[model samples]
Target: MNEAAGDGSSFSSKVIGIVFIILLLDLLGFTLILPLLPSILDHYAQAGDVTYQSLQSVVDWFRKAVGIPMEKKYNSVLFGGLIGSLFSLLQFLSSPVTGALSDRHGRRPLLILTTVGLAASYAVWAVSRSFIMFLLFRVIGGICKGNVSLCTAIVADLPCPKARNRGMAMIGVAFSLGFTVGPLMGAYFAVSSKTTGNVFYETPALLALTFSVIDIFVIWMMLPETLPKVIKGSSSHGGDSMDLLSPVSLFHFTAVTRTKEPPSKERMQKLQVLGLVYFCYLFLFSGLEFTLSFLTHQRFKFTSMQQGKMFFFVGVIMALIQGGYARRIKPGQHIRAVYMAIMMLIPAFILIGLSWNIAMLYIGLALYSFAAAIVVPCLSTLVADHGSANQKGTVMGILRSLGALARAFGPVVSSSVYWIAGAQTCFLITSASFVIPLFLLSKAQRSKEE
Candidate 1:
């Protein structure tokens, strides 16, 4: 029995290790493309393709209605924002369903399937010759984007919240590493392609595909089913009752609340409040984040390589904070930590918005990276504490879904504001808007205390 216990511990360690490595690789692929998006859009636009012209016309009409200047750069940024929103929208639609399905079936199989789908998306991207084909690639990638939430659920399946918090921190580290290395590689390829006068983006696409394929194989070979069979059987209605198409049920997490053995009403309310807080936070954050590339390009004339270097800086700072500071945060102390992180962002964005030089920008980015490192991972840890063992997947899924929903609309709205009102105004307004989520989070905490 002692030997068996040791074996179980070993297996859990191995599983967590694999999860970390896989996420690191997957994020590397995901971030690799982010820095290149604006360039890709410009490529198609310059080609005078039908798809680009059609989209540009709609964007131009909107700009005219808003009385903004008719600059082509604005069109590309707005266009990129739309594409980013589309990806998030698909993720919003699919994440919960994927989570619910994983709950009903198991994590291993779902991981394999979704990873395969992601690989196929990258495959399409590798051969894409037109805006339409690239759009299809985003569609496919977004639909298969449930792997992150599933990994979170797996962490939640751990024996205790403390262990889960550490796991969440590990995941954050994976994100940090991925973001750090991916953009640099992307920038390198972009520079190389530009020098060669052929910028089709096949190399990065192929690299992403390779990572996805390796992830699929790793999950298939190594990841044990973290969800117990007893828990699996009970999740039969995991997310079945929640209307996938409806925002009402998805935000409220009816999938978890409506379960055969639901959490208490108070718990449900707390979860719902938490979900809203996450949505509001990401809604504000993602908008600014998605536009950062355009902001640097327009303000500082940052080339692809410069943009890559900028992200590398952010990623490194985020990783260090997650590893050195965030992981050490006590389990029940996450709410306090989250408060501190949220407070940090208010000034971070202000500095960023007001920056007249790279020094001020980096200062803001440092604060931004620190806050980013702490908040989401801490929130994930806190949320995991609320769910029962069986409801882990549904709970994590709904949270991710809410975040996805925020991401879907955040970029479009923020980008529109960006083009019309200018980056400084957009950043200032959004920075102040962070208060909304902070207030909501405080309310949730008070309710939890009550």
Candidate 2:
């Protein structure tokens, strides 16, 4: 019996490892296109290009409605912003369904199916020529990668509550590395293509496709059901019965399960506060992230390669802090650390908004990366600590959805602000954007104390 138990533990650990690696690959495949977005949009923004007319048509609509000045920058920001936001929008719409289905069916099948779908999207991306087809690829990829929360749900399902934090940290490590490596390789492939008469322009997509195929194999061979059906869909709240196909269900977690016993007044308030905090924090940061490229390119004349390197450095810092220093944070102590990190971002955004030199930009980005690293895992573990075990998966899924929803809107708003108000104004606004969350956090703290 002892030997059998040990073997079972080993198997579980192996499965967890693959999930971590696959999660890493999923993030990597997505971020691989980050450094290339500006160039790609510019590529199709010309008069004779296939995507130009359709893209410019949208830009013209925005101009008429908002009275924003019209220029090539309008087309560029719209294209990139739309592509980025669409991906997140789909994730917002699909996350809980992915989570709920995994809860009802089993993690193994959902995980495998999502992986296969992602691989298929990459295949389409590799062959894409026109802007419309590439946009189609983005939509397909968004639908495929909406499994972001299922990974968290699995971590929450861990038998040991403490283990969930460690697990989320490990996932964070992978997440950090994915951002670190993806753009670096993307920029390299893009720069290399220039020397080869521009044939390698499609190289980034091909490489992302290759990674997706490999991820599919690893997931197929190794992963087991993280969430078993027996414990999958039981509602602590009454039987709310979520239909993933319903449009209304997309916005509400209640679509997943009804309440048998509604949560306490305190839990409801905490979740509400946390949801607001999560949405606001991600919204500001993602806006900062989405517009950073424009700011750098305009202010410092950065190439795609330089931009990729900057992102790489940020990822390095993030991985180190999340994987190493974050472990030292004890369980109930996460709030203090979260408060500090949230404050750090204010000055960081200011530096990015005002940076006109390489040194200043890198310094600001390093600070930004550190705050992000701390907030992600700490927030996940902190929120996971609340709520009943039976309902934890749904809670985490909802949290991920909130973050995704914020990201969906972040880029569009930030880009428009940047276009209208200038980079400095845009960054300054984002810097002050934390005020809402800070206020919410203080109220939550007082409520907890009371």
Candidate 3:
């Protein structure tokens, strides 16, 4: 394929390194804002004296705009997630279009655009004085940030099949590392800000915004244009015909069209099975976000710092499993391991629901994180293996869209469950949700053997 161009070792290394850095920066900006949100809302709600009146007015305005109940200050977290889900929805909507754009307009502009959008989002969040303003900024950020799609595209462009899994695993590693480090940074900011008693200064949103600016600068200076230009007057014949700028016409170009084996009935069945598995995986994954945040607040009465630290530990476990062990396993075995890991999540969720203190929560989080790390890389590898090279971008785009859809509903479901049955019941229901997928995966395995 394409004469296997470039020094394989160096090329592999560079791809992984660049992607890892990109994911790290992207996730770091994300995680830094999460833990501090509930605290920020509570802080503003409980302010004293003259400042309290202003803060109260801001909170009241937010509640009215978002339709959140006035009794619950922590509803801020739910609203924040709702806002984030809107962003996820935007990502879901744009993924296919963006993937197609990358195919047409090339990857460089999209990448640059995503970075700039993220930076702008952070800037909006940092300076936001009201909840409505915050939500508006988050939506803008969501519309702009397409890091997941872009990173996947980068992997598609640079790596071969055999090395692709490893390349993706490195992306997972970057996510885990960012997960680990970002919250710690956020926690530090929150604690220092708490100690100083400066309302505006301690905001995690501002910290996230600063990192985004740095990321923008890094990308602008260091990242190269990965899309090559079509040679003038060079076609499959003697004529020059490719139009790079026309999004619609670019599909007709030879670069976008390549022959591949059609999907057999059997392959279609397998894909259906995998798609089901992914749907369930994302549902459970989204539920965990709610469970963790709710449980942290309920069981240990954790401060923002404590919550951030717990996530940092979860990130560590994920980094270890994804980075250290993913490549050691074969593809089939990796999938099987991931299935077992999903099963393991039952106990982890149960433990989290039952956790009486921070220590127990940490233990549960670690187990959950390790299981998650295994599942993500394995599922991604499976999708890549099942897809043809020509349709890889499209298939991945669909998968990401499904994930975004799941994320959109996940928080809403989790919040509803928490409200109805309480934290323990919410975890129990989520635990039960894992079982359906495990059974489906088993059935798929049996069908495959046949």
Which model scores highest in lDDT?
A: 1
Q: Model 1, residue 265: displacement in angstroms?
A: 1.5
Question: Lowest summed-lDDT stretch of 10 residues in model 2?
Answer: 1-10
The superposed Cα distance between candidate 1 and the true structure at residue 330, in angstroms, equals 0.8
TM-scores, each model vs. reference = 0.96, 0.91, 0.82
Top-scoring candidate (TM-score): 1
Model 3 bad stretches (over 4 Å): 1-7, 44-81, 194-203, 225-265, 447-450
Better of 1 and 2 by lDDT: 1
Worst 10 residues of 1 by lDDT: 1-10
**RMSD of each candidate relative to the true structure:** 2.3, 3.2, 6.4
Order the candidates by lDDT, highest first. 1, 2, 3
Considering summed lDDT, which 10 consecutive residues are worst modelled in model 3? 231-240
Q: Per-residue lDDT of 166-255 in model 1, one digit per residue for the tens?
A: 678899999899989999898888677667766548788888998898888888776778887766757654347545547898777777
Which residue pairs clash within candidate 2?
237-258, 237-259, 237-260, 238-258, 238-259, 238-260, 240-258, 242-255
Candidate no. 1 TM-score: 0.96
**How many pairs of residues collide in model 1?**
0
Give the per-residue lDDT of model 3 (tens digit) for 347-389.
8888888888767777778779978787776776776555444
lDDT of 3 at 413: 75
